[model samples]
Target: MISVFPEVSSQYLIGGEWKTSSKIKEVRNPAKITEFVGEVALCSETDVTQAVDAAENAFKAWSRTSVDERAKRMKEAAEKLSTVIEEHVSLFVRENGKTMVEAKKDLLRCVEVMSKGADTLLEWWKPVHVEGQAQKVQIRKRPRGVTAVISPWNSPMILTFKRAIPAILAGNTVVIKPATYCPLTVMSCLKIIESSFPPGVINIVTGSGSVVGEALCGDTRVRTIAFTGSTETGKKIMSLSSNSVKKLYMELGGNDPALILPDADLNEAAIKRIRLGILRASGQVCSAIKRVYVHESRYEEFVDKLKKEFERVVVGSGIQPDTTMGPLNNRSQFNFVKELLERSKQIGAQVESIGQKLDSASWEEGYFMLPSIVTNLSHDSELVRAEQFGPIIPVIPFADLDEAIEMANDTEFGLRASVWTSNETAAIDIADRLEAGAVFHNNHTVFQNLRLDFPGIKESGLSQETRWGGLELFTDCYGFAD
Candidate 1:
């Protein structure tokens, strides 16, 4: 196998081996588009079929492998992952365009997610007992064959490994379909970690989602698909999987809200909203801070403070020292964000362009954009209603708490929201009303608590994940009483 740090391009990991294809796609560094990162071999539908076939064959034995053994192998993978983490850090910055701090956090978070799944698999995958008058009942969990993990480039490693590990721990084999733009990072990590598993147990097919993703989701042998991407793409996968009534685990888009109550701290709220909106993945995250709904009493104060903080954000190449954020990950995303900003102006939204570019000339060579703040937008405006997926913050003022809640819940997304206030009682009351899976009392975007459920309602996502629910997701429950 080639080194994790690729020179030009890398091969895919299929059936625990590196395989090649005739088609190759170029991967440019988003931080400096002129700099060639590498290339990745594109696989076809036949490759996806081969991967599913191998995973199906492997599942027969892997499913029966003891929990202790599976956990041990996963731990071994984690340890190996740490030893080579620096190489990953450097490569991640070059390929994905997230700052060094963000890249490091991404790597650590991925390890934490996978290790947590491995550590608790034995406890999470348990049989339940219920007593009755005549007979006792027991619920047993059974693996659901091969699981297809179709992961996106935004938080690629965390979402990919997090989705894949639970299914594998539940005794299901896995076929990974990584997004084309960031395939090398995932493929290299898998290359390092795949050694701990038996052949055919874990496989990956790299290519465009239109080809390989459809093939994996449509296959009858692939019983489950754990996906993390846009709601539109999730719908397509859902349709494809319906052919076989396959299980679908989706984490879709979000227009996440940050609401500031009348009694909120402007200093803290301003900083948190700015950081959450752009410092993370250039705001490409699915649950990023999308819209800000501040109490009209404090709207001007909050907006002014947020604009000042957003101005200081350091935008540059990811590998540079003291860089707070990096470029947009790809050309399509850059163009989309640019157009969104343009539309915000066309619709009469008050737009404030903020943020610093380290090298103004280098901006032309990279997919870089200074973060902008858009205010005075109606709830129905394109910038307010849609997921921009970039560093564009739309601040909308609400007259009362009820209006704030209404605006927060207006969207088709329910990933998360933040209620910034001092009073715990009011915070709880406000959080309870927001239509989202998780609510922060103050401000926090990305952190994992094993007990908390990471799910989305409405168009944001389907089904629940993390904690015990995640393990059960990969299994079909069966019980019988005598």
Candidate 2:
């Protein structure tokens, strides 16, 4: 067995202390399944009860602390966390199957979220004086007690902090449940930052979502639930939290589309960004460009360029320096993508499998596949309609802007969409008619869309995440009459 980060702590963090569970689960390296990464305690329902009890006990004192003091501690915690992020990059790659470069970026983003979340909290919590009344009145934000953060596996570290940081800054004690598939990196990061707050302010439990996840959402002690994952699981969380009427912030799945107008530029840099938007994390990201709509005049040219870009990719273990893309994170996702591709072929879709295998000799050892491009498919085909959640993309030709808009808006999901055109006026016009939470003018990817609030419409999600909207979700406004 190949050893990776064997010394890193993976125990459950409860009440500001590391505790062990009776049942243990082994962690495997997704890039090389036979290799052992580490182990995590499988917490039970009783553990969830104890963790929530501790949070309830601590919320009284922590919620009363000055907002300025909370912000100061969050900044300090982020600074301390930055110094240790580099040490766990390899562990992240082994446990999560992201390239070393992507792993580093994932860990580093946590610091930025924590620091910026604190800044947003300060800006959002200022007292607002309301006029036009006989007497003085002011509106202020108050903390929602005990937020439950359940994060997914694809980008675990940053997503957890994206919710947890603001909830804490708003004086809400939190109990976090990291994805069972990738818990080590999140546990390590949370362990490092737990010292900055009082006991029970930050707690984590590791186990199956069916066990720990349901408990966290259904528990009456929890006042709010912030989750990021598939729409199916988001629905389950809603049902569980509904009994208690908990405040819910859900960031669900998306089948995002990109429309390339005839006048759009397909330069080398632009093509590269488009490819990255589709292939990043092997398309495991929720907002990745799942399908593309190119004008009939430029459809052939765009497909040819994208095919060339796909051919240059090298898939293998993320730790290898020469590898550009890594394997799927787990066996379930790997199998799902394989079946989707096969179904596309059976239905007579033009599925072009391109890309070089970094190690053809050991290809069967991991959940690896060459990135594919699908063309000559109907808009309603499963390959074009489903999220896919893999490195398979469909490029459809649209005769006009109206046809393109109609095809893109035909999904139950309305998470994000993008339009590519030289004319800014044309781009805004299309964006206005698109049925998505956020629309981009030229480029649409994680980094390009981070500065603004991320909301989803229709079946995509409830509420929003990131920016001021995220901070506001963990709080409630109060009017003081004088």
Candidate 3:
């Protein structure tokens, strides 16, 4: 079947040029299973070395450039990105399996992060002047040389730019290894950047993570490794990176919780946030609201309201204008979600279908699944404790604020949380006590501020993004005393 969107060129960008090889991987549209969108070259170990060498050579000159110069280059790249918004968004929808609306938003977020680097870096770059006895001390920020960034398949473009933009603004050369499944979007973004920056400043390679990722992290010249993916893989990268003691920034998995208090506005606050949590990006977000702890007094009402609202979501191909949710990125993801739903059923969780299934005629071949809500599950159930990266949410009942807070903090992953309550003081009080790195009071946990720092506390990974603090992740701190 011919795809609604035409097949576009898909190739790797290394040292300011597009590359193709005899070995290419076909990229399929998740919404149209038979459609082949394009093909990407599978980088071998030699390609990985070449990309790394380009970045290494670029760092010598690029890292020495004034911060102002680097900022100018980044701002230009951001403006160039704006011109390709439609094209970039189209690629995101086709390659990453996100709805067109969501893709646009993600592209805009990437621009926001890149364009605001000047202001973001200024705060961290401020010279620390210390008046000491008989001498003066001033501390300055320095680049960490070449940085290797390995991004995941979900939200590929946004996460890739998140790490790359900051690293570049801090005057560090970056070598990107994007997930093979969604390298097209990142390659498109990199093409725009390559046109603006000098050769070797920014390079991209496409290949399996195990082969390409290990070589990049294990390279002695690569000074830092910023990764975003599964916790198990993150641990392996950490072990491999120990040889060089490369500076590391890991953003792993998350199992966020949303607590609904008895006094909360179920209609406005609770329902709206819950819908965003599980429904946004088809529930593929790391900080997605996977579990909900509702006050027993309002449990039934919350569940009913959520079901009605979830039913209103429209699922279709990401390129369609009316699509609010898209198919899972691939078959593995679809099966993983299906397995989780089945497990919930076996555990005696009350399973309820909330959204309409995709049209059997057009979408039958795609990796699609229905939106689901499970209730009456104990807090200790795996459904409640584990991260469900799908359109499934489990609702657990709590008797009081103490119990709600306890349940919210019970997980080993402390990435994000949300609390909904009518009382402003009570909401803020509870927000302060939540164990997660970020807490949303009377709102959902999906909101991310580009100027504010965003990261997790525990297993959710190390480091943050959006602010000057993130810029420091690509820099090395040095001390000098005389």
Candidate 4:
């Protein structure tokens, strides 16, 4: 029962203009597979070249613009965007399959990030003086020319602009290639902010990643690549950018964990993660809590409560007033989660399909999936070890804190993890020992304080996405004798 976003244009924003392409793609509603949201342009490498060239040409002048001016423009755009925010939010739910609540958060996050990125410029750049030998030295920060922001489709607009906002605010021209699955949402976002800056300062190129991604990462004109996607794709970007040695800022995949200690609020800990972290975005979040480690004393009790919570979740179209969860964004993701749940059961794990389809007759025709909860899974099972990127989660019981930490650290990814305990000392101690880029003492989510650096350890990522760290990421040191 969702209305189509009237102006989901199937065009590219290049050099401050909306350009059309011969090649086209369809943007479909995941909740109603046959329904087309709109047609989108499938740009080729040539299109990417044009976009990058525009950005490169603009960067020389853009980099010269004062930080104060850049911040002011972004602030103005944020205010302008707030007025038409509902239309954009609807686009996200229609195309991205985010629940109403989740869509609102994504839209708000985009605005907040833009506003925050602007405010950070107030303190982000500073000159350092170094008295070396006989001459005084001034270390200055300069923009890295054209920065390409390659964002993922899961939370398309926000993820793309989250990086682009900083790059632009730091005086670098930006060319963004949002995921083809939801390109128009990103385009719609760009359309609002496009007039806020000089022509060619902000651009959105839509197409298959193979064509556009290769072009962006491989383009020598693009000096920095801020990418967010799978770790495998991150590796490809690294190799592609190696020739130019482009500065790479990547926020990749994570198999985040939630560790519940004894004496914790078992229901709150489990339900909070399930509702806010895993079930949000249909568990498409890069930092979603994929694994859970519960203390032996509360293991059985926690499992019972967690199972009950999943059962109460109403799964249906995001537009439904009562729907608490929505469909998987696409088929490949749905298939992967479905297969993983089957494999866990085959491997002797206690797999329970707490899934009761809300719109049963039409659910399968679309990508709607009932949230599945797995218990008694080995710490080494695929479900526990890999990121499902869906509403399915595996709960593992641990005997002690030592075993919990050891089990948690056994993943190839370290994006985020949380420990639950009423003991303030124990919570802090546990949080300190985790290997994630960020750890929460009692709660976890991808949302971060805009002023703090949000980066991951191990393979989770290679750069920061928050205020100061974000600004510095797009700059190169220009040190000279004063």
List per-prediction Cα lDDT, in the order shown.
0.83, 0.89, 0.80, 0.82
Weakest lDDT window of 10 consecutive positions for candidate 4:
1-10
Predicted candidate 2 versus true structure: per-residue lDDT over 259-361, tens digit per residue:
9999999998889889898989988998899999999999999999999999999999999989889999999999999999999999999999999999999
User: Which 10-residue window in model 2 sums to the lowest lDDT?
Assistant: 1-10
Model 4: how far is 22 from its true place, Å? 2.0
* Best first by lDDT, ranked: 2, 1, 4, 3
Candidate 1 C-alpha lDDT tens digits along 89-173 = 8788888989888888878876776687787887866678876646887888789999999999887887888778778888899
Task: Kindly list the per-residue Cα lDDT of model 3 for residues 200-293, writing each as its tens digit.
Answer: 8888887788778888888888899989988789889989988887888888888888888878887655577679876788989888889888
Candidate with top lDDT is 2
Per-residue lDDT for 340 in model 1? 85
**Per-residue C-alpha lDDT of model 4 across residues 140-189, encoded as one tens digit per residue:** 88888999999998878777767888888889999888887777667776
User: In model 1, which regions exceed 4 Å deviation?
Assistant: 1-8, 268-270
Model 2 steric clash pairs: none
TM-scores of the candidates are 0.96, 0.97, 0.94, 0.94
Better of 1 and 3 by lDDT: 1
